[model samples]
Every structure is written in structure tokens, then in C-alpha cells.
Target: MRAVRDFASGIVHEVNNILGVIIGNAHLAKKSSANAEALEKYMGEVRDAAEEGRELMRHVAVLAGEQSSRARPLSLNDLVINVTSELDPPPELDLSSEEATVQLDVWMAREALAGVVQFMAETKAVTSLRVATRVVGSAAALTIEDDGASPTDDELRALFAPFTKLDGRPKVGLQLTSLADLASRSRGYVTAGPREPHGLRIVLTLPVSDGTPSGDRPGVPLSKKGV
Candidate 1:
């Protein structure tokens, strides 16, 4: 298992490096284009394709169990707020607030946020995504509900199966699984289920570090961390 994980991790790293070069060259090409007509369109596609590939590689790494787990103090409230704002959900979604604070790793928070965002974007059924975060004694919780088409039981079961794309394409389901793994590593867990009436709800619960301050430290970068 460890050998397989290491091999997968190496592949992901190499793929990411290649993607970085592709994106860089594409950006340079875009800038150099004086006409900005035909070349611009092609460059845009290249950029999108490269980004998608990178995301796929990330998911693969998680599925292969190639990533190490790290835990630190984090601000649950702030993380959810930032993620929701970035998603820019439609007005139809209602988001609640919980006046609590807790600690977790920043990387895990970002992965959870990205997973929700990618799921929504791919399904296209979600009109809105809302998040509510709360902190209790020695633990933190985040509840993300999306007003989207509900997945069947089989689909939900397949969610964490590596290389299983919900959209019937080659997609890596690493985001959710990686988040779950990270939570478990931190003495926590994650759950996903149907929301009231309709839609999907994902809840993340993790051990909270006591009175930890959020700051810019030399921890793992979100992109390089894992899928």
C-alpha cells in the first residue's frame, strides 16, 4: 500500500509540473498575441484543459492515499464564510450562521471548500450553496448544503471511489475522500446525505485546537498538499 501510494504521488507531482509549464506557456502566448482573436480562443481552451488535468491529478493522489495528513489550528467560521462568498451562490439558497470558533488545518478547510464547489459546478443542478459553521468544546463542525439535484444511493456510495466521475466522464472523486481522510487523521469524521425537501448536505467534524490563532505560516500550500 505504501509503495502504491508513493508511486501515485510521484505521478501526480510530475503531472502537475507539466501542467504548470503548459499554463505558463499558454499565458505567455496569450500575452504575445497582437490579434487576440483566433489565438486567444485556442489559448483559453488550453488553459481550461490544463487546469482540468491538474484537478484530476489531485483527485488521483487522494484516491491512491499518497498524501500525508497535517493538523493545525484553524478558524472554522472564517473558512466557511470565505468559501461561501467565493462560490457566489444564487439568492435562493439560505445560509445560516453559528457564532462559534475552533481550530483545524487550513489545507483541509480549503479542500472541503473546493470539493463542494467542484461538485456544484459539475452537477449544474445547484442553484445555491450555503454553509453554516460552529465550534464546540474541543471540536469544530461545518455543514454545507446545496440546492442541487440529489444523488441516488448508488451515486453517493460511489462518491469516494477513485476515478469515478459523477458526470460519466474521467473525473477523480478525491476532494471529498481527501477531506474525509484528513478529518479522520485529525480525530474527526465527515458525513454526506440528503438535505430536507431536496438537495445534498455534507457535514465535517474535527478536533479543534484550543485558542489557536490563524496566521501565515510555512505550512503546506493548498495546491501542492493533495487532491
Candidate 2:
């Protein structure tokens, strides 16, 4: 199928990027052997890249239903906070006050969200990003908005289509397609539309476990980091 091929192409692209990191860092490590600090830094980068490649393979396995039994109930709010905090330039968070625990594989969900955020942050046209969450009916919605050049409806559709490449923005198509695939596996859905005036809005909704408010509402702490 075309979808499968697009997914494969995207995976190859991502794997190439990871391998570039590993190879570049390895060479740096070799060259910096005399400088203990530089050598350690390069080695660390190489190790991190290798671990990322390993995780990517695991993600592929999970997507193929080989490791589909690893999901658990987790607080969506907490996961969002934890993952976003680790981003190089963390996005602004306007998270939900209520805790919405959902059944999900942490790695899959984390990678989906992080990949999107990172893509947006790296985009030359995007200026700002805001992430928010809300419990809508039986599902929890994680929405990410960006102040960037708004895509037309046709463009938006292409972004969510698996393997649908975009001009100079193939990564967007790849990331969102992977996200759509993962959401489908969990009985969730992804929606995207042009934001008012300008920019784009994307929402990922997943069913919450029991739909009960388990814990006290957390305080809203704004992260004022530049994107």
C-alpha cells in the first residue's frame, strides 16, 4: 500500500538522521581523544544517538503489533509536562487542571508528542507554540497550536496522510502520519485545522480510563521559554 511505503520512506529518513548523529559524534570522539572533556562529550552524544536508534526500532515493533501489550494507565497531564520539559526550547504549557489518566504506551505517546513539537520548533516559519489539554467527554484531548504560516485545507489533509510528502517539509507529513497511526491503534483520533488569522492547530484525543477525576487539580505553571 502507498501508506506503508510512505511510512517506510519516513522511517528511512529518520534512521538516516540518527545514524548521521552517531557517525559524526564517533568521528569527533576519535579526533578529540587527547582532550578528555571533548572526548567524553562526543562519546555521550554517540551513546544518546545509538539509544535513540534503538528506541526507534522498538517503536517500529510496537507499531507492527509485536509489542502491543505494554500500554498502561498513566496521567496524561504529567506525561505532557515531563516530556515537554526535556525539549531543548520547551514550549509554553496551558495544561488541564484536572488529571486525565489514559491507557497508552508511554514511549509511543511521548515520541509522538515530542516529534511534533520538535518539528514545529525547528521550523523557520513558526514563531510560537502553546500546548493544552482538556477532558472532552470520555476522551482527553491534547492540543498543540502554533503561530506559523497557516496551511490550507488541502495542505492540512496531506500533513496527516501517511507517506504524503510535502515540499521541504517532509518531516511534518511523516510525524503526523505516525501520530495518526498510533492514535488509531489506541482508539484515538487526530484532527488538524488552520488557526484563526494565522497558524495551525492539531488535537490528539484518546479515551480516558473510567472518566473519573482521580486526583486534585494541579496548579497551572506557565513555561516562558522561547521556541
Candidate 3:
């Protein structure tokens, strides 16, 4: 299937790119005349690149495993805060929420949310990655938005499909396609689109806790702009 091919392509592309960085650094190290400063610089680059590759592989492996069986009713808003805080993300990250408690495998749900937060953090042009949640009927929608990284309609169509580096940007990374897969396994759905005025937006919908939706609300804190 096209989906399978795309997933394969994405994984290969990202791995190759990281390997390229390591190789380039090795070449520089070989030519550095044994100078401590030059060797240190080259070694540092190699180490950093290798670490990134390691993290990617670890996360990919986590995603590769069977979905977590520990499903429960919990507040997604709280999950976002907990995960992002652990990341020490940019100060510009504005996380808000109304009430959005959904039934999900917390571990897998955390992984999916981490993918979104990590991708946004990597976008140098992004001013801020804003997150919010709202409840409607028996479902809760968590919207993650950015003030940068706008994609074309065509790009948007393939956003959750697979492939890396769309339009010269990290379109997916272990992107939405993986998140979609994880969400589906946990009985949820995810979608993407351009936000109003400009920017990228992703909304993940899941069944609400207790099958009864809470009222809609935005980030209530003025300081961090969180719920």
C-alpha cells in the first residue's frame, strides 16, 4: 500500500540524513591534523548527531511496539503540560485548555503528543507553538498550533501520509502519520490544516471521559497562557 511505502520512505530518509551528519563530521576529524580544538569540534558534532540518531531510533522502537494496554480516563491538558515541561521547550509555547479528559493508553498518548511538541520545537522560524483543547459532545479536540511553518494545500494533503522534509521543512519528522497510527490504535482520530491568517494546526479528537463532554475553554493563565 502507499501508506506502507511512505512510512518506509520517511524512516529511511531521516536515518540517512542523520548518518550523513555523522559521516561529514568524521571526514573533518580525519583532516584536522590532530589539533585538539579541531578534533574537539568535530567530535562534538559527531556526538550530537549520534545522540539525535539514538533518540530517533529509541522513539521509533517505542512506536514500533504494541500499543499500551493501560488505557484510562485522564486529562489531556495535563498530559500536554507534563510532557512539554519535561522537554524544557521554548518560552513561547502557550498551552491552554478547557476540559478535555479522554480515554486512552497514557503511554502511547504521551508518545503521540511528544511527537507534536518535538516537531514544533525544531522549527526555528516558529514564534510559538500554541496548544488548546475543547470538548464537544462525546469527543474532545486538542488543537496544536504554530505561528510559523505554513504548508501548501498539497502539502497539507500529504501531511499525515508520510515522507520527511516537505518543502524544505521538517514536515513530519516521526510526524503525524505515526501519531495517526497510534491514535487509531487507541480509538481516536487526528487531523491537520492551516490555521487562520497563517500557520500550521493539528487537532486530535478522542472520546471524552465518561462519554460526557465538558465545556469548551481556552488557556486560562495569563502567565503561561495554560488551563
Best by TM-score: 3
Candidate 3 residue-pair clash tally: 0
Could you give candidate 1's per-residue lDDT for residues 152-172 as a string of tens digits?
Answer: 788677655433445432244
- Residue 187 C-alpha lDDT in model 3: 82
Question: Which is the better candidate, 2 or 3, if ranked by lDDT?
Answer: 2
Q: If scored against the real structure, what TM-score would every candidate get?
A: 0.63, 0.68, 0.77
lDDT of 2 by residue, 161-211 (tens): 644544434255346756787688778899988787878788999998864
Model 2, residue 189: what's the lDDT?
91
The deviation in Å at residue 36 for candidate 2 is 19
Best-fitting candidate, scored by lDDT = 2
Report lDDT (CA) for all predictions: 0.61, 0.73, 0.71
Between candidates 1 and 2, the one scoring higher on TM-score is: 2
TM-score of 2: 0.68
- Candidate 1 Cα deviation (angstroms), residue 96: 8.6
> Which pairs clash in the backbone of model 1?
58-227, 74-103, 74-104
- Worst-scoring 10-residue span by lDDT in model 2: 218-227
lDDT tens per residue, model 3, 186-221 = 688888888777778888888878743222222322
